[model samples]
Target: MAAANGRPVAKRRVRLLGGLAVAALIAGLGVFWAVTAPRAVSAERLAAIEAIEADPARGERVFWAGGCASCHAEKEASGDDRKRLSGGLRLTSDFGTFVVPNISPHPDAGIGQWTLDQFSNAMLAGIAPGGSHLYPSFPYASYVRMSDQDIADLFAHIKTLPASDATHPDHELKFPFSWRRLLGGWKFLFFDDAPRTELADGDAQLQRGQYLVEGPGHCGECHTPRNLLGGLKTDQWLAGAPNPEGEGRVPNITPGSPSLKSWSAADIAYYLESGFTPDFDSVGGSMVAVQKNMAELPSADREAIAAYLKTVPAR
Candidate 1:
């Protein structure tokens, strides 16, 4: 009884059922996420948002502070390594390796069309524009504190960047690790929706510096070692962590550490600028990548970051 193609109606029904089955499978996966995914904001995050006006104009600066572009961007072959913001960089880990996505302003490929709520959910909730969970590599836990206004502005600025349609490489995870649903349990244990604690006596500059380091710079994400479960070891904040990407462990940059005891905030500031320590030795590994972002920051802001680091409870 097929009228359109003159094919058997029974055959058409079978084809339609097959297609619907696949769609059902995908939709079921999405529903599983909707039920199991973590979603809870802590009180501390709220206080930080109250302090700042959420202006896209200012959000641009905060975006830079978070170093959103550095990890997201592809590294160039040149020694100086230009091409900021455009992403194709590969990040390797024991569980997997992920090539950064092209977060550029490409309308079809990038975040150009993402709604503000979508952007906020991505940053704060660790959920992509759809209800799907983003890989933890995005560090949404640290970014959860970003005010809605600031997130909105950051989204706007990202939309303005030149788009690169370079496709992102698939993450190569081992077994259950490759499964996104496996991350739901990991999130339950490690992900904190609480925003950062704002210092009342801390001046605006100090607060800004803190936000940059803890939120966007996500310096702690790498520098601060995590427990077996992947939560930052609260007792050993910023002491040092196993270098997931490199051979050697990430060294402690805290002032209390012997390596940094001789150095002043000014020295750290200079090192961040030149990628060279006071002893004229070059710093390497992921830090080199971070310095690339730091180098672009204003001197005063860099200084502010330096001053803040100097006070970080040593080791």
Candidate 2:
């Protein structure tokens, strides 16, 4: 009888322990779901953006400043072909080879069905339609700094572009990196819309330059180094970084860097406009497309960009 009583006690203890273990697992999953959930812009803000009348003309300026064509256009696309946003460019990174998606106006393949509110949420919140998280490779991290009006205008301008049914392959990512839910943790740690560098005595031109660089131009995406998790190292803003695509490093543009220290603001402006450096070397590599887009901008915008670069903190 004593032996039988002890056996029952042991069985009850085992059952209690198993129940606790199951409870703990359920709680863990709940926490993970909460952390990884997509967060879109507040409905009130979305309403305000919807009310703003967008101008395609102003959006053209935002389009060039944002360098949308450089990544979205076909790899061999040139001249008027750049306007065809049938995304096929393959951007290789440490995480994976991200094939740019078709953002053209095609109702089926592109974002033609996306409303202005959806576009605003994607640009500012990194949330995609149907509540999926967009990978930061889209550079929504920097675009989050853009104004509502600019987002509105940009959507309008993009609509005017020719639509293409051209579809690209999905991103090829390694192991755990392929999981989109993990991106919420990454964004939680690194995504910030704050100004990268603060100007001491900011003027109108300096402010304009700052907006173009920090908001639309997204220069830091290339010039600034990133942490192991692919987060931008804000402490070393514009200090230069290893090129993610191929050989050599992206040049540092901060004042403390020896390469840019010698170039006057005027020289920088001229380089953007003419693609010729002070040494008469022409822009090459990925920057060639960037320079071409910069050349199309009004001279003042180029000057503003140059002026802003002169003020960023040295690495």
Using lDDT as the measure, the top candidate is: 2
Candidate 1, superposed: residue stretches over 4 Å from native: 1-35, 38-59, 77-86, 193-204
Task: Work out the TM-score per prediction.
Answer: 0.77, 0.93
Which run of 10 residues does model 2 get worst, by summed lDDT?
73-82
Q: In angstroms, how far off is 165's CA in candidate 1?
A: 1.4
Expressed as tens digits, the lDDT of each residue in 1-315 for candidate 1 is 347666667687989999999999999988776656755333454344444455666666766667776677666333323333556777887677776776767766677677666666678878776566677788887887555666756776676566767666577777867877667777777777453333546677777667666776677788788877667775676788888887788878667877888988889889988888988999786677678678877887788777777767777
Residue pairs with clashing backbones, model 2:
none
For each candidate, the alpha-carbon lDDT, in order, equals: 0.71, 0.90
The most accurate candidate by TM-score is: 2
Q: What is the per-residue lDDT of model 2 for residues 1-315, given as tens digits with 9 covering 90 to 100?
A: 889799989999999999998999999888888888888988988998899999999998999999999899877568988888899888899998998999999999999999998999899989889888999999998999998899999999999999999987799999788999989888888887888888898698999999989888888899899999999999998899999988999998888988779999999999999999999999988998888889889999999999988888766
- The stretch of ten residues in a row with the least summed lDDT in candidate 1 is 76-85
Q: After superposition on all CA atoms, what RMSD does each candidate show versus the true structure?
A: 11.1, 2.4
